[model samples]
Target: QQQKCKQYMSAELKIPTPHSDCKTACILLGQSLKSDLMCQFENHIADFMDGLIEESMILEAAPVSAVFSSSLSDKERGKLRHLHPHSQGKQFISRRSLLDELFEVNHIRTIYHMFIAALILFILSTFVVDFIDEGRLVLDFDLLVYAFGQLPLVVCTWMCMFLSVLLVPYNLFHLWCQSQSSSHGKSRLCSWLFGSVYLIYQTLGLGFLPTYVVVTNSFPPASCFIIILEQVRLMMKTHSFIRENVPRVLTWKKDKNPAPVVPQLSQYLYFLFAPTLIYRDKYPRNPVIRWSYVATKLLQVLGCLFYTYYVFVRLCIPQFRSNSLHLFDLRAMVLCVFNSILPGVLVLLLGFFAFLHCWLNAFAEMLRFADRMFYKDWWNSTSYANYYRTWNVVVHDWLFYYVYRDFLWMSQKHFRTVALLCVFTLSAVVHEYILAVCFGFFYPVLFCLFMCFGLMFNFIVHDQRKGPIWNIFMWTSIFLGQGVIICLYSQEWYARHYCPQKESSFLDFLKPRSWSCQRPLMADS
Candidate 1:
């Protein structure tokens, strides 16, 4: 633990003097307690100096940052500017995730308990239904099995993506930074050469390769979705790393350091596993791993998975497996949509809890990645803009910092609305792509919702909306939107399979099969 603190202090504080560095590391690690190392050092000073110790060696009563820079060695002060660079004054402060802190409150923990209780009810209801239908309780996971089919292919494709991302971007940056010491023409030539290669890899290697494997291999929805999601995640991480670090490298190059300082391989490796899209040499981390906390979060994720399965079995399947599945009436479509709201809302909540809350917190705990603010109180958001900002802060931070901020910086901050639109468009496209691959069909319900209604809401309901009514409106919109998503996707999923295309055409793949196809979907027995 002391070693970890020293490492963190070295990378994060960048303190030069051994005395200040060790003292600060100890203070941070032990938090408000006098450090054992400091005590030992003091004792050594007393023995070595024969009770006549020097004043310069002792840690001051003032703040570490104040005394810290005064003790900077000349070599460190000179070389420091060229290393890892980011926004000044911003530093990773070790902190708990919102949910973890919230769970300390009785009311907040009760809400969590409510979700667990719902899971219990779902399990009991599934058993009851099975007992009534089969004359004995039946345990089955046919849907789960089918969804997560083709696991081997998914694993292989993921490894390929991970390896390519792990190697390509960091190596490119390292090589490019090293080449900065060469002649101007040589550096410029190498820049284009390395930049082109990196772009090609990002597009083809990270983007297309895994997608091709997923598409051609006929992986199931769960398998395909995970592979694609991972591909995007890696791509985003690499982008953020490069965007954040490239300027730092250039700044270091300008300093004419004989050896350019790039990020360590260890830092890059940590970023890959850390539950954050942003890249930094170090993050605020915990002193020790809580295995029990990790276990609880993972178990909750598993429970949420089963809860979703039963939701599909009890609510979604029975409704979507319609008697009038062959009908193409507006009335049927409306009923399908309205009937989907409850199940769709449940799925949305379960997904948020499972992935954003449980899964992320589990990984964060294991990694001791202390900045756990993966999301916020999006449920309480009164405005669509606030909701969007708080929904998935991990993603939002990437879009805001890299996409939105960069766009504004490029455009001189005049096109704020345009930047916002760009974020929405990119998010919508990626979302639509995920759904399309998973369900094995092209449906733009979410895309339309994001681009049209979502964007409109963002403008109409700005941060000025603080009333309770606005909150009501936001939730009502969410409920309706969830209904549309589930209903359309469910219908299109069955339609694509039940009414498979005869001969391929451009319109055939683009068009919605549910609108015209006349096959009735059979409910699972």
Candidate 2:
């Protein structure tokens, strides 16, 4: 039987007699036995030989032989099929960002050096001006200090949010899972009751508690930002946990014979702190935590903070400080817009570096999470579409998975455009909400730019326009958009402060004070 199997395998596979082996024949036969092929050849030796002859004839009739198909294109050879965008899988083992690899190149390293040089020049210029104007080189960081004030309260709030996030989701999910496994009616009912109560508690703790603190204490913008950002992070983390695990619990409830797999609390806790937004049972991790690298990233974050302070003080503050509302004509607006471009771009870059790179990398290293792809080469993108998808990959991943992809699935893949619109709308609303909450106002400048101009650009200047000019256009748009946001928001911010209304009303609060800062001519007369 073994000899006959070997002979059949050799003839079917077109292997030479000299190279034919029993082990290979046995493996092939084992596979066949596990499949329907075994049934066709089960009758006799004649049947097996007939099947092999048919297979060989089919192989010979093919246009291209597998052994000599090098002339074929990758598509023809089925080699590049996986390269298709939809064919690619969403989740995989983590890898470093493209910029991290580029930093190893000499040319890319030069760019880093250039940024350092610019920082040094800014420092020197500040010192020289201080010495010349005041006959002293005293450095004041009062703005920076004020921006980051109320640290103890912020820390306490963050700790409270973190504890709630760490404990609530896991415990609720655990209870649900246990209830799913239970056979008794009373136990299941009790579990449901406990879960409902726990969820309400979580809602109040995660949502209302933070907002109450921020509103009651009249937290500064920066301090409010800390609480709001933490709230967002914890909410996202909890949603991800529920999204990933709940279906499994439901599935297990249906099939109660086999035990369900539940991830450990340690794994969930680790995921809460991990840089990536996706939840997983386990993630690729580094063998050792690099303390030096962590320290360097932390320092870079600090440098970025200082960089933002300097840019605002030198470029933004002075531009808006002395300008009266009556003097804010078209010329003033144009000048302010142009002047804001440099500082706005600098702030954008510093923010991208500080949070996406430095802050994420620091946390990733500390946690030994090997995947560090927090961002991509968004600068090189020629379209706003690509820019949105590539920039802030962490958020993009979550939005794509939870919002875009899930919407498509729910809609049975019919409403693709609607799904995309939903994504854009959600993103725009979230951005506007964050800004409104942080700034304590309802300026929808970001919303207008994002939903209107940004959405238009996404379709108009798309990924198909692959040229240097298109890239330049995209960058120009980015600079102008940033300038407009900085200029208009800064102006409104100052206008509110300098020209407070006699009595605060909802209409007055919602109104843009910058537009009506100067009283009516009749009132003045």
On lDDT, the leading prediction is 1
Among all windows of ten consecutive residues in candidate 1, which has the lowest summed lDDT?
A: 61-70
What's model 2's TM-score? 0.80
- 317, model 2: CA deviation in Å? 1.2
What local distance difference test score does each model get?
Answer: 0.80, 0.77
Q: Which stretches of candidate 2 lie over 4 Å from their true place?
A: 1-89, 182-203, 502-506, 519-525
Error of 1 at 165 (Å): 1.2
For each candidate in turn, give its C-alpha RMSD to the true structure in angstroms.
13.3, 10.1
Which 10 successive residues of model 2 have the least lDDT summed?
A: 63-72
> In order, how many clashes per candidate?
0, 0
